[model samples]
Target chain A: MWPPGPRGQPRRVAPTIMNDTLLTVENLKTYFFTERGVFKSVDDVSFTVPRGKTVGIVGESGSGKSVTALSILRLVSAPGKIVGGRVMVSCRGVLQYAPTGTVDLLTLEESEMRRFRGGKIAMIFQEPMTSLNPVFTIGDQIEEAVALHQKELNEAQRWEQVLEVLRLVRIPDPERAARSYPHELSGGMRQRAMIAIALGCRPEILIADEPTTALDVTVQAQVLELLRELRERLGMSLILITHDLGVVAEQADEVIVMYAGKIVEQGTVRQIFSHPRHPYTRALLEALPTFHTTGRLRTIPGSVPSLAALPRGCSFQERCDRVQQRCREEDPELMVMGEGQVARCFFPEL
Target chain B: MGVYLFKRLLLIIPTFLGITLITFLIIQMAPGSPVSLKIQQMGGEGIRTETVSKAVIEQTKKLYGLDQPIHVQYLQWIKRLATFNFGDSYKDHRPVLTKIREALPVTLLLNFISIFLIYLISIPLGIFSALKSRTLLDQAVTVILFILYSLPSFWVAMILIIYLGGGEYLNLFPVAGISSQGVGELTRWGQFGNVLWHLVLPIIVLTYGGFAFLARLSRAQLLEVIRQDYIRTARAKGLSESAVILKHALRNSLIPLITLSGTLLPAMIGGSVVVEQIFSIPGMGKLGFEAVLSRDYPTVMAIAAIEALLTLVGILVSDLMYVWVDPRISFEGM
Candidate 1:
C-alpha cells in the first residue's frame, strides 16, 4: 500500500484477500525445538477462510494440521514456537474487544488474545470424551465460555445462554443435559456438547480439529452432519481439519492438501479431487477406497518422511513416481497450475 | 447417598468388634498382667512375705475381675463399652473414660491444629510447585521437602527442643507441656496466646513431616491433572492461566487428597506418640503408649476401640468427600 518495488522485481508482498475473507494466514511457520532436532511442524503454510465457507485441510498424522489451528489461536505450548508469519483475523463484525480491522493475531498480547479465542474464533478438539472437564457439569462449562466472552450478560442470562447453546446442539432435555457431567453423556452427546461449548460465544470462525475422529463411525457421521448444519445455520466460517478425504469432499468448498508439514496442493475440492496436480495429492486420492476398486486397496509406496530429518530438495522426491535429477536438486515453489489451483511440484499432472 | 452412608455406618460395627477383639487378645497374651506386676513391685521393695503376698495377689485378682474366665472378662468389657463406660485403668484405679477425657482434648487440639496448618501450607505450595514445575524454584522446593520428609519426626522434635526450646541455643518457646505453669492467671486471650506459644516448637516438629508428605502428593497429583486434555480445553476456552489451573485442574487433583484424608485418623493418634513423649505433652499418644507398656487392659482397649471407630468414620467421610469432589464416583451401587 505504501512503497512500490523496483520495476519487474519480485517482492514478497502480502496476498490480497477480497472483501469476503474472514481470516488470512500468510507464510505461517511453526517449529518444535526438541533435544533430538528441530521439527519443522508447519513450514511456510498459508491459506484463507472465505466468509461463511468451509476450508478443509487434509493430511496424515503429524502433517501439522492441528498445530496450524493451534497456532492460529496462539495456543501452541512451550518447545513449539510460531517462528514466522502473520495470522490476520478480520475483526469486522466479530466482537467488541478487537478493533474493526484486520489485526495480526501473532502480534497481540496473550491477554488480548483471550478475547479472540472462544470470543471471535473458537476451537473444538478431536477427543470429545476428554476435552470436556470431567468434574464440571456440561452446562457449567458452557456457561463459563459464555460468561468469559460475554461479560455484558448477567448470571441468569448467562445460564439461559447455556441452555440455549445446549438446545442449539440438539441435546435432548437442555436443562438436564446442562446439569449432567461429561461422563454422564454418551460419546455422540459429548461431542455435541463440545460443539455447543465452542458455539457458546457465537464465534465468527470455528476450528474443528478432527472433531469426529475419536467418535464412533455412526456418531462420527452424526457429528459431521451436525457441524455442516451448524455452519450453514450460523453462517460461520469453519476450518475443518481432518484426515478423511471424503469428509472434505462432502463438506468443504476449498481444500488444502498437506504433505510433510507443507501444503502441496490447494484448490477447490472438486478440482483437487478430480484433477490433483501434486503427486502426493494424487496418491492420497488413489488411497481412498471407492466402490469400483477391486482386489487390494491402493496405497502410497512409502510413509511420510520424518520431520526431524527431511531430505533436501523435495520432501516427496523419494516417493514421487516421476522423480528425476532436477527434482533431487531443487524444491519447487508453489506454482499456479490452472484456474484457482496451485501445486508445489515442478512437473504438474496437467 | 443417604442409604449408602447408612449402610457404610452399619458395616463399621462388626469391623470395630473384630479390631477390638484382636487387640484385646494380643494384649492379654503378653507376658504380665496387672496382678503379676503388682506382686513383682511389692517383691522388688523387699516386702515379699509368702503368705501375705499370696493373700494380697488373690485379693487383687478377684477385685480386678481377673479371676473370671477370659471370655467372661471380654464379655463384661464389651458390655461396659455398650453403656459408654470403660472400666478403671489398672495402672491407676481411675476410670478409663475419665482418663481419656483428660487426654483427648490436648491430643485433638495438637492434631487438628497441625492438620489444619499442614493443609493450609501444603495445598498452596503444591499448586505453586506444580505450576512452576521443572523450574529451579520447583526443584528447590522438591529437594527441601524430600529432606524434611527424610528427617525423622522424633529427631526433628529433639533438634527443635535443643535449638529453640531453651536447650543450648536461643530460648524461644516452651520445651515441655502445652501450657506455662499458673497459666490461669493470664487473661483469656493471653491464656490462648500462652498455650500457642508453648505449642510452637512441638507444632513445628509435628507439622514439617506432614506438610512435606502432603505437599509432594498434591504436587504430583496437580502435575498429572494439568496435563489432562480438559485443562488444555480450559486454556483454549480463553481462561486465564490461573483459572485454568485453580478452577479446572485443582478440583480433579483434590480427588487424591480427599482419598488420603481417610488415613488421618490412625495417624492422629499414632503419629503424635514420639512428638508428645518428647514434648511431655499429656496427649493420647503418650496415654496409649503407657497403657500398652503396663498392660492396662481397659485403657488400651478403650484407645483401640476409639481409634478403630474414628478410622471407620474418617474413611466414610473421605468417601463422601470423594463423591463431592468428583461427580463420576457414585456410591449408589454399594
Candidate 2:
C-alpha cells in the first residue's frame, strides 16, 4: 500500500479500485448488560464501507454511533458486550481465510484480532489532547505502532516509515516534531501526530469517531480536508462518526441517520438529503438552521428515548410529527425502499 | 536541579533551629527535670542520695551549663550544634552523637527492609488486582489487604510477638535486640543472617500497613490511569493487553508513587516507636522515646534537628523526581 516516492511526494489515486465492499457489518447488536436487564445500545444495525469511499454515521449523543465503531475493533469495555453480529473485514490484498474470503472480526482470536487491528483496520478518536501520551515523544508513539504491526520491516525501515507517515499527515519539520512531547505541540499538531500513528501501519480502513469534534471550526475544516486528501492518497475506506450534519454533508459519500440505537434512514448522501424518508431524519434536517432557512431553528418535538426505557413500538413515535396509531401498535422494521436505501418507520415521510 | 538543591540546603538551617527550639521548650516545661531524674537514678544505684542536696544539684547544673538563662543556654546549644556537638546524655554523660550513631543504623536497617518489601510486593499486587478487578482473586486480595491495613501496628506487633516469638506455646526466632549474645563470634554471613532473622517480627509489623496502603492506592490509581484516553489509544494501536498495561499504563500510573518517595526514606529511618519498643531493637525510635522520657534535652534536640533536615531534603528530592517521572513537569521557567 506504500505510495512509491521520496517519502513526502504527493500521490494520486487512480479511481478504478473503489468499487468493492471493503467491510460489511451484518445485523450488529451490541448490548450492554447492566444491573437492569439488557440495554440495546446498537440493535440490529447494518452498514458497509466501500473501498476508497466515506460512510458517515450521524446521530445525537448515545445514538450508538461510537459504539458501532468500537464494536468493529472489539474495544467495547466490560458490562457492554457485542452479543450478536458479524463484522466481516477483508484485508485489501489478501483473503485471510481461504474458503469464505473474509474474516469475522468478532469471532477472531485475540492474537489474530490484534494483528488485524492497526494493520488492516485502524481507529482515531476524539479529544486529541487526552488521546496522546503525555510522557513519550511523538516519534516514539508513532514508532510503537509501526513496530507492533510492520514486523517484516527492520528498525531503520520502520523509522523511515514513521517519518513517511508524519510527512503524509503534513507535519512540518518531522524530525523536530518527533522529538517533541505531546504537550509541546499545539492541539492541531497533536491530532496530526495521532493520525500519523494510526497510519503507521498503513491500514486500508480508518474508523474516525468524531475526529473533528474537539477542534475549532477552522481547524475542523483543515482536519476534514486532511482526511479527505489522505483517503484519496492512501486509497483507504473511512467511516466517520459525527453529530454535525454539516460535517456529514461535506465528507460523507453515504449518510446514516441513527435514532435510539437504530438506523432510521440510510442512503446516498444526495438522495437522503433531498428525499428524507423517516420523520426523525426529516426533523433532524429541519432542526439545522441553513443559510436559506427562515425563522428560528425548527427543533424536534421530543428528546431521544433512553436505551434502557425505549418505546414499545417505534422509538421515534413520541417525537415524530406525522406519527399515526399504527406507529404505536408495532415496532417498525428496516424495509428497503430505493437503490440501496433503507428506512425504519411505519409511515416514512416519502 | 543543582541550584535548587543548593537553595534547599540553605533553607535547612532555619528549619532545624525552629525544630530544636520547640523541642527545648517542651523539655524545659516537661514534668521531670534532668536534675531530679539523674538524682533519682543515682539513689536507685545506691549512691549517696541524702548528700545530693540543692548545693550539689546547682554545681552539677552549672557544670552542664544548664544554670544559665534559658536564652543563653539556647544560644550555646545552637553554637555547639553548628559544630556537630550534640553535648552529652543527661542519664550517662555519654556523647549524644555516639549514642545516636549506634541506634541510627538499626532503625535504618529496619526501615530499609520494610520499604524494600513494601515496594517490591505491593506494586505487582496492585497491578494484578487492578487487572483482575471484580474477579474472585481481586476480591480476596482486597479483603485480606484491607484487614491488614486496618489493624493497628502496635496491636499487630503484640500479636506477632505472642505468636511468632514463642510467647507461650513455642519459641522460633529470638524476640529481643538485633542479635544473640554470641553474634560477634559468628562468621560475617552468620552475623548478617542473625540480624535479619531478629528483624523479621518488627519489619513484618512495620511493612504490612505500608503494603496495604500503597497497594490499594496504586490499584485505584492504575485503574483510573488505564481508563485514560492514551491507554485506549495504546490498545487501539494493536498493542497486546500486557504491553498496553505494562509499557504505557504502568509508568504513568506510578507517578503518584513518586510523590510519596520523599516521605519513604525518612519513615524507614524513623522506625515505629511502639514496634521497636515491643521488639527491643534499640533503633532510633526507641532512642528518641527514652530520651524524651528521661528529659535528655541535648539528645532530644539533636534527633529533632536531624529529622527536620531530612524532611526538607526529602521534599526537595521528591519535587526533583516529579520532573523526571512526568515529562510535562519540567522545572524550566518556574
Quick one: best DockQ, which candidate? 2
**Candidate 1 backbone collisions, by pair:** none
Q: After superposition, how far is residue A84 of candidate 1 from its true place, in Å?
A: 1.1
The list of candidate 2 runs beyond 4 A from truth reads A1-19, A94-100, A293-295, B1-7, B45-51, B166-168
- Overall local distance difference test of candidate 2: 0.86
User: What lDDT would each prediction earn against the true structure?
Assistant: 0.88, 0.86
Summarize candidate 2's per-residue lDDT along B1-334 as a digit string, tens digits. Answer: 6676677678877887887888788788889788888888899999988888889899878887889899898999989987999999987889999999998889888887888899999999999999998899999999999898899988987777787788685577778899999899999999999999999888888889887888888899899998999988898898999999999999899998978878788766665788888889888899999998988888888888888778778877888888989999976644
User: TM-score of the second chain in each model?
Assistant: 0.95, 0.94
Q: Pick the candidate with the highest TM-score.
A: 1
